[model samples]
Target: MKALPITVIRSIELLGLVLLITVLYVGSSIIMPVLLSFFISIMLLPVYRFFRKRKIPEIMSIILPILLLALFLAVLVWFFSSQISVLISEFDQIKKNVGMHLEKLSKWIESSFNYSATEQTKFINEQSNNILNSLGNILGGAMGSFSNFIIFFGLLPIYIFLMLFYKNLFLKFIFTWFRKEDHEKVKEGLKESEEIIKSYLLGLLIQITYMTILLGGLLLILGIKHALLIGVIFAILNLIPYIGALFGNIIGVLLTLSSSQELSSVFTVLIVIAIVQFLDNNILMPRIVGSKVKINAFAAIIGVVIGGSVAGISGMFLALPMIAVFKIIFDRTETLKHWGVLLADERPKDGENMI
Candidate 1:
């Protein structure tokens, strides 16, 4: 029998990828939670091991790590709640500031471009109504989905616990899919993936701490209000890679504009954020997270976009480590090694060897 033509093979491959993406998109609600639990369980493994070494019961060991996670989450929620209450109290003032800024902007536009305030008010009103309508629709949809969101988050700890409890069973389940000869390779890949997940989570925790201190401290020194809130918000959002950082910048600007009396303060905030991001991307993040993940920037950015498209915010946060795990598996399997190379950052030995 003749082999398939090159074009046919390429077309089939592309079709397969499209189908895979479609499946992921359709099943994201379930798949995303399970994937998140898997990673979280992996991150808790070291803690579980410590308990086991001290002669604790397996069930208790699992519960201990989960309890710690719960405590951490509680503190996070409390902090955010307090900060948000502070913001809510300032809402009236913020509204006044916004109106003043808008009036100033309208005047500038009228003088600079010969646009009348009447026309500006009409345009702004029209756009504002449209935006409000869109927001209403979005909020209504969110209310409908709120129960599912609660269920998703509520089930996460249970899922994590079950995953940790049945870790050995899952290991056995994995090996059952392959022959004895391939077991070692699969085992090695699993170990590497575990390390990658653990390191990535720890690195993120470190990133958040330093980023909040660096960004918030700088802004506070610069006499910016709500500096800590802005810092914390940006740090958390930055978990989503390139897209998150851009959103963080927008949030920073909006917050600065609302709180600051001078327009120069907005530019100052942006400059400071840019500097922090530079340090993060070049010096801090590379040493902390990048070294552990070993994924190229191109692959990371694509993964983030695809992940966001498939599963929104959760997908974006999970993308990098998930890709790294896939790369580990691909490299361990002989047939898929080239795919791993494509996902990696190392420069190819020769230009012509590019994937």
Candidate 2:
């Protein structure tokens, strides 16, 4: 075989990378529904196992969880719908307060920076339109998909049921398809991936609960109305990381301003969110997630951003778990463990050995 020129080699490498990314994008779109069903299955598996280990009938285990999950989802939908209705009913006041807040903010910026009021207003107007238009775009496609939305919704539960039933067989198939020498490694990888994903999901739920309690307590002390509503919304939103908390706080402050028009209230909400973020970043994540997922901070943030860019909210939520799964599988392979290690943040020091 003839040796390729350096330029040709570089071109080939770039082409390969581009092709790989394109395939990944296409594959994600094609397999996203199946993956989501599997994600739900993974979450329910532990509960199923907990019951099965006690000699509970497998059929009973499946029926119980599915029924409970359906009830929980119904309650969640009702709660969000009621809260959203309240907000929509108060939209007039909200619009007024928002406009007033913008005026105050523009003036404050001008006074602080010694800029012309006219220039500040112009800048604010330009920025606000861009923000609003972009928001409209984000929401534009959402409401128009009624038929498709119903179809997807109708399929989800059925998919979840089938996924739970077939999960073990799927795992066995994966192991059997691999070489005999790699069977143990593949099995271990699958187990680790399952544990990591389950832990991450549970950690997320725990964090949301913590944030709700913390934020709710603070808001109550600060005499904010609808404290529970705002706190819960922010807590759930905070799950998406950097942008999520920011979005949550922005909405919280807006609600506070509309309800009271008190700058101090807004400032307090901002501080509460900041403190919660600090604790979450430094404390909650490590203790809850346990680092076995093998995603580094930089990659985690970048993955979230890319996910948000591609699939919006769902993407942001799935990005880290997907990356963690990749890391887990990669780590199980001798040739790929180095790459997986690079993806991991925590490493043992001194004479410690990692399993």
Candidate 3:
């Protein structure tokens, strides 16, 4: 058969990409949990293997890891709930502080802009009403999605268990997809991908631990209220790459502002976050995570935005690892090697061209 023109082939590939994305977006509710479970299972693989090597029962091996995950999550929930209760108990103080800040802001606006205090109050009330309405709509939507939240979590363990239990079968199934001669390459890809996932996931856990300790510890020492809560929130948010850190900073500042009347606390929070983030980005992350998967910033950002668009926060969180896995697959496949290059962070040497 005559080969298709290069443009035709490229068009076909682009169309396939669109279709795949459409499918992912449309079926995200079903697909997100599976993807989450897959990653979780990969992270837990070593634990499962350790138990298996010790001659533990297969069922027990799986159950043990899931139990460990559950216990950790439960403890996290307990801690947050406790902290939140404390925050709630100080609600009166927070309300007063917020009112004071608003009054000061209103006065400043009136003086600087020649706006009357009455006009400022009226404008504030109008904006406040709009914000309240938006919040109400958001809360209603959240309540509607509460069942989905339950279902997602409820099915996660089952999916993980099944995936682990039938992992060998899945491996055989994957091997069957390629030619016998290509089996070695496929095996190498699988091994590399597994190492990448494990290393990336484990590195993230370490990052979270140190981030929480550093941020929370510093804030605590500085006499910041809800220091631990801010630390925990920022650490988890920082999982989403560049965007996560921004939101983490904003939340840290907001929490600090709400809890403390002093504006200096906001600056303190920002400065501490900046210093910690610098250390994390420059030193800690490089040492801990290394360059197991060297995705360029552009690709990482785009993947995160697309993932978040398709599947919300879960998508954003999973985007990097998913992209890493795809890069491995692409690099191993001759036709898709270009896609891998596109995702990679490597720069060309002088006189060296990618093509």
Candidate 4:
């Protein structure tokens, strides 16, 4: 066969990329749940195997691991609900604090920028109306999201159960997709991808635990109100990589400021968050998550952005693992190894130019 022109080949690749993205976006409602369940199922494989090894029935083996997962999620829900309830009980105080801050801010603006208080009030009222309209839209979207969440979780256990029960059949299907000579490479990819998903997911769980403890504990000791709520919010948001931490900081500060009139408390929250995040990014995460996936910062950020654009928060969370799996497959294929290199963190050798 004649070799295709380079431009034609490039165009074909680009077209495939576009089609794949479209499918992911269009089918995200179905696909996102399946993907999430697949990763969770992989992480629970050992637990399932342990039960089976003990002569447990197949149904019991699957149910037991999923029950454990449900228990963990239940605890998280209870914790957040309790914290948020307490926050709600203090609503009047929070509102008063917010009003005081607004008055201070308006005065500062008037003194510094010569903006009249009446003008500022008018501007704020105008913006508040706009904000209220946006909030209504957000609430509507959130209702749809909540319904999707129910459906996602409703199907999660069933998907995990079926995936576990049919593991061998799935493996057989995968093996049949490749040539006989490529079976070893296929097996290697499956094993490596499983290990990566398990480690990555478990590492994130540990990260969330320690982050909440460390940040929440410090804030509580420093007498910050709603410390646990702030901790929980930041810990969950921090899962989205670079952009998440920034939002976490903003939220942490806002929570702190709303609950207290003292400026020092805001500074305290910021300093503590900065210190904890520094430790997490530098010391804890590196050791906990390790460098198993080896995705570059550029690739990770882009993957997160694209994933968010395509499938919202769930997509962003799944992006790293998906990219890792892709890189593994790409590296194993003769024609795609260069694409794998592009996703990796490997730097050029000394005296070598990237080009």
C-alpha lDDT values of all predictions: 0.90, 0.78, 0.94, 0.93
Better of 2 and 3 by TM-score: 3
Q: Which run of 10 residues does model 1 get worst, by summed lDDT?
A: 346-355
Q: What would the TM-score be for candidate 1 when compared with the true structure?
A: 0.94
Cα lDDT of model 3 by residue, 92-201, tens digit: 99898888887888889888999999998788799999999799889989987998999999999999999999999999999999999999999999999899999999
RMSD of 2: 4.7
lDDT of 4 by residue, 7-93 (tens): 897788789879999999999999999999999999999999899999999999999999999999999999989988888998999
- Candidate 1 per-residue C-alpha lDDT over 1-355 given as tens digits, one digit per residue, 9 for 90 to 100: 9998968876886798799789889999999999999999999999999999999999999999999999998988898999889889999888888888988999999999999999998998999999987998899899978987998899999999999989899999999999999898888888888888989998998899999999999999999888998999999999888888889999999998888668998888899999999999899977886677989989999999999999988999999999999899878877567778889989767656564
RMSD to the hidden true structure, all candidates: 2.0, 4.7, 1.4, 1.6
- As for candidate 2, its clashing pairs are none
Residues 1-355 of candidate 2: C-alpha lDDT, one tens digit per residue: 9998968865885697478556656665445556666777788888888888989988787766777778877986798798788879988887887788878887888789988889876887999999997887667677665655676667777888887777778877887789999787787888788998899888887887888888888888878867878888898888886778878988887778887676888788788778877888888877988765667788889889877766556678888898899787667766456657767887669788765
Instruction: Choose the strongest candidate by lDDT.
Output: 3
TM-score top scorer = 3
Report how far off residue 234 is in candidate 2 (Å): 2.0
Q: TM-score for all predictions?
A: 0.94, 0.81, 0.97, 0.96
Better of 3 and 4 by lDDT: 3
State how far residue 355 of model 2 sits from its true place (Å): 19
Lowest summed lDDT across 10 adjacent residues in model 4 is found at 346-355
